[model samples]
Target: MAKSKPVLNVALVGYAFMGRAHSNAYRQVNRYFTDCPYEIVPKVLVGRSAGPLAEAAGQLGWQESSTDFAATIRRSDIHLVDISTPNDSHFPLTMQALDAGKIVLTEKPLAMTSAEARQMAAKAAALKRPSLIWHNYRRCPAAMTAAALIADGKLGTIQQVRAVYLQDWLTDDACPWLWRMDAGVCGSGAHGDLNAHLIDMTRFLTGLEFSEVVALQETFIKQRRKPDGSGLGTVNVDDAFLFLARLSNGATASYEATRVAAGRKNYNRIEINGTRGSLVWNFERMNELEYFSFDDEPRVQGFRTIMCMNGGAHPYAGSYWPDGHIIGYEHTFVNSLYDFLVCLKNGTDYRPNFSDGVANQEVLDAALLSAQRKAWVTVEQSQHFAGRAEPTRVAAKNAGL
Candidate 1:
């Protein structure tokens, strides 16, 4: 008989929206995917206050809670640190975890700036530890199906890509000014919160890197009363952003993100055009992928929707529901956590690591520069000017010049 492997003990930091979402993933992954090599158990929850942290831990099914992050990371027993903290703390926590030789999983927009993201990436590369950036949107069924189709050459030579992520949470004046409204805590507003997902999805589906961008950004509601209602605060970051970009593969891409879109509620949509066919995906209808094949008779050419029923037929589908059954938003985090566990078992690097985080930040930096300069800005130029190392040669080569 073979010796059983040990379960991976996870210490999660932050107990808010993302914290709850990730904790649910840790609980669900092993329950559904019995074949997973390493079991993930919620070992600890870390936050600012012991009271809130303890309450969150109990509610989220954690075995224990701690107010000190350094002490949690220093524990020899904790195998992984899942950071769902605000943007400002991502770098410090990730760097400290890497120094302590623990695996790290951080929420997206990896850091406050490309330079900081680069430093974290370089440190992780030097230490050779498994670090995953949680771009959970890539784990969606439709998005994964689109990636598979494009990779299989079903969609030949990608020609263009367009993405829009819109929401109405901040459209009304009554929406309280949270951390998201403060640039000091959240980095850029809608661009980082929303466009980061869109940028990564485009890269995932098309396997292309953005080379240049011409963009515009705006702050529709410049002032809003603080949550305490004591006074008003100025909105320093853009409420909306739009851009035109060129990919390394000579493809054109357009992007838009806005928190002030009145009717749209968490609408993240993507469309890809290629020489042979095209694909489209929308988060609102996550279980379906739309495809258009030019090979069909000219008169019959039109987008056809395919239902993504989870089972042995689809990647990761068999882990959960039977065929034709549906999954929801939380499942993406579960799938992502499952992938991290597999990588840990195989001693392999996970997808969308810190380097990818830095690359995404580079695009965000370039978009900001374009918006400020009122001209097209090259990503390389922005990165170089910002004093960060250029993306690795492997990234450049895989981008398909």
Candidate 2:
């Protein structure tokens, strides 16, 4: 005679890389977080082609498929709209979902520009609709452990952050042009796709906002064959972007994101330095954290590698395998969705909501502006971020930092 839980139907857009990742998260969340508050139904998968959509739907475990995105968003049965589409589509899709009184979860870098992100945030806030952005790295158990240690003053008075997200996917001339290489679709290439995570992770680990940045970017190969094999198209986005920033806490930071890093495939790494200690978490070795503490006895002072998968201690660990057992990248998405569902059950606001997206987008747009101008740009570039929620602090300090 247990009380039945209410069902929350999800209509997801896109069925490619992110679409598959998100679909897996939705399916696995309830299974792992058994105490999860709702019966999450992966109701419909929406995409451009009915054939591919149907095939992806079946493969990804969604119950339905549709090509009509507008109709799907308006469906009363759909409680959540998941916009995993390209950067150009996020603002419009989220705005529609918000207008329809549906909660939304979207991929990162929010929108094509800071202005678009602000509008989405304002609309979601005004309509009182809940929203989340899938900055899944913040949920990685090792990353969360870094946050906790930083929050506990292990990394006292943060001084600097260094981050890089590297890949080799676009290093080859033979790699055809796709939506990602087009600025009109993805905002910025490696900067938006890779550094977005680095930027957000810096803010999450230190609880500090960016003050200003000086940046430079480069496009290695200017053109590539179009996806349709219809000759070549201009590659308008940066293949590599590097920037230095001044953080709100007077800390210094640097970031590098590139798709031209030969022999490097998904080397996402972050390191933080403070007065008393330092920590590094590389997604390449995601389950372990390297720690160095000046406070330790001088004889024993060196980096110690701590494995973060202890079910008794690490966040999200108890939900999975036994102590010392590791998890792969996809588990981060599951952890994020599980947290979002818990927030829904308690009627509490979720971190990295629409407002967080606005914050992240502002940093992104500002960096691009700085690169274009070949000068420093403040994170709050006035006209660009007018009427936006202050990006001074993260949504709130959760999971310690």
Candidate 3:
């Protein structure tokens, strides 16, 4: 008889976009990661409406559904609480879950404000519980490869980074206003929704802390039809945001995020230029990493495109399709979940934890402040915690690229 795996019962809140993604990851993680220490069970699907919650639970492979969040999270059987709600609710749900002694997983942006994120981080630290914020892009095999290379000094004294995340979803004035448009809910529009990933990724790849930032932002559409069909609602968040920054290591960086950029849809791109080499990663071609090295002979000095789908040499690629066969965006979430579980099993630390989330929030806060003051704002990043081990650094070693 085979030994039984320990079971982890998960209670997931919210049933919207991120909720669907997290649900898919939870269902598929153990299927691919057979060595996973826990038999992850999508135990309860919690939400505001019973009908939609029940429907989503069945479709998403959850065993049960409930609308009572307070009671559901407090259930002794629940071991993990995943918050997929809007940005405003992150702090409250996380605090309650931590009080219940449950491991917490939250979507990006962490909270609507840095103060809230700080409290969340502090509580988790005081309780000595591991809390994770889902910054899934870091798990992309190519991105992990880039981190590994930079860590090994292949980038050799990084001097600059340029990152942009652009989308055209709201370019049309007809696009109705959602919670994302309300600063009270999402903190900021493109700045929080998109640049949050860029900020987190740049740090992950280079391990550099942001020193200061100067920002400019705009709200292209001031108002739009509300979801309730009531009337035009005010669009209080930024439609576009851009910033320049200096890293702790004296490296310079630029970042931009926008939903009004024409002809661009989900174009999350980043390029790093260093003393010895340069690296580029784009979400549109996630399986490829563009690399240039000064070590190459003058005749062969052009950039080389590496197909990161090689199972034997790429991080997280060996878990799926054969070499040269690519995976999709969904797989990144699974990789992150698998890594988090492995961290739990090994009693190790995980990246993008509560403290890391707090640091990311600090940058966002500073950017917002900079835009308001029309001056550079120093990033208060004392909370940025470097864990004992990071999955990407490990994957980079395995790839040896």
Candidate 4:
């Protein structure tokens, strides 16, 4: 009999929304995706609060819990360090793990600033270890299928990309201001929390890098009561953001993200138009991809809604469910972890690496700059962190400088 492959020990930091989502993924990925070369075992859960941390560990089926993140990352038994902590801690924890020569998996908006993100990416590149940024939306079956189609020339030369992510959680003035409202903790509010997803998806589907962005940012409710009813706290970040972008592929992109969209609940939608065809996706209706092909009959050339079933034709879909059976938001993390595990086993570079995280952060930086300056700003020319040279800002040829 052959010796069994060693299981990959996993340690997760943070036990809230994203923490639980990733924990569930670790628990479920191997059970469904049997082809996964290494078994993933939940090793440790780390958090600041002791009570909730222990409860989260029990609920998530981790072997143990700890408040010291440094100890968790330094443990010799843990093979991978998953950072699901707040945005402010992502860079420090990830940097420690990388310096320790451990593989790291981190939640998005990899750092508070593009310069920080770039430094982290540069470190990972230097170490040549497996470092993945958790841009889980890219793992959606519909999005992945659409990306393949675009890559295969099925969409021809891409012309435009429109992406919007809207949620109603902050619609009410009575909604207590949380860490997400703080620029110090959450970075640029909805732009980092929500728009980052669309920006990454835009790059994922269209294979384009943003050249420049013109953006407008707004803070709808300026003041809100604290969650603990401690008077009122001023909202320091934008509740919503809108931007127009030019992509390196010569495609145009329009992006909008809002936390106060009245009727929308977790609405994430994207549409890509190319010379030959087009594709669209909505998270509200996760299982469907609407597509249009000009090659079809002219009379019936309108978009056709294609139900995405993972059973046979789709990648990673066949393993878990049959046709028309939908997977939810949590499953995206599972798929992402599965890919990470496979890459670990095969020594392959995973998609949406830290470099991708830095790139996405650069776009976010450019958007913020554009909003502040009230003009088009090129992403490549923005200054990310302290002591970094300014990025080169070149006017588009069409702009007629």
- Highest lDDT among the candidates is held by which one? 3
* lDDT minimum window of 10 residues, candidate 4: 392-401
- In candidate 4, the residue pairs with backbone N, CA or C atoms under 3 Å apart (3 or more residues apart, or in different chains) clash, namely 310-317, 381-391
Cα lDDT tens digits for candidate 2, 1-401: 76777899999988899999999998998888888889889999988777888999999999999887777877889999999988777877777778778998989889877787889889888887778999999998999999999999997899999999999999899999987887767778899999999988998899999999989999999999987879999888899999999999899999999999999999999999999999999999999999999989999999999999998889988989999899988999999998898998888898778788877888888888888778899987823533212222211111111
Tell me the lDDT of candidate 3. Answer: 0.88
Report the lDDT of model 1 for residue 325: 84
lDDT of 3 by residue, 273-392 (tens): 999999999999999999999999999998999999898889888888778889888888899999999999898888989999988988988888888778888887323322112112
Off by over 4 Å in 4: 1-3, 384-401
| lDDT agreement with native, every candidate | 0.86, 0.87, 0.88, 0.85
Models sorted by lDDT, best on top: 3, 2, 1, 4
Model 1 lDDT per residue over 1-401, tens place:
75565788999988899999999998998788787788778999988777888999999999999877777888999999988977777877788888888988999899877888999999988888878999998887778888999999998999899899999888898776777767766778899899999999998898899999999999988888897978988787789999899999999999999999999999999999999999999999988899999988999999999887667556777877778788889999998888878887899878888989998999998988888789999997666434212222221122111
What's the lDDT of the predicted structure labeled candidate 1? 0.86
Compared to the true structure, candidate 3 yields what TM-score?
0.94
Task: Indicate whether candidate 1 or candidate 4 has the larger lDDT.
Answer: 1
The parts of candidate 1 lying over 4 Å away from their true place are 1-3, 384-401
> Residue 20, candidate 1: how far off, in angstroms?
0.4
Model 2 vs. true fold: TM: 0.94
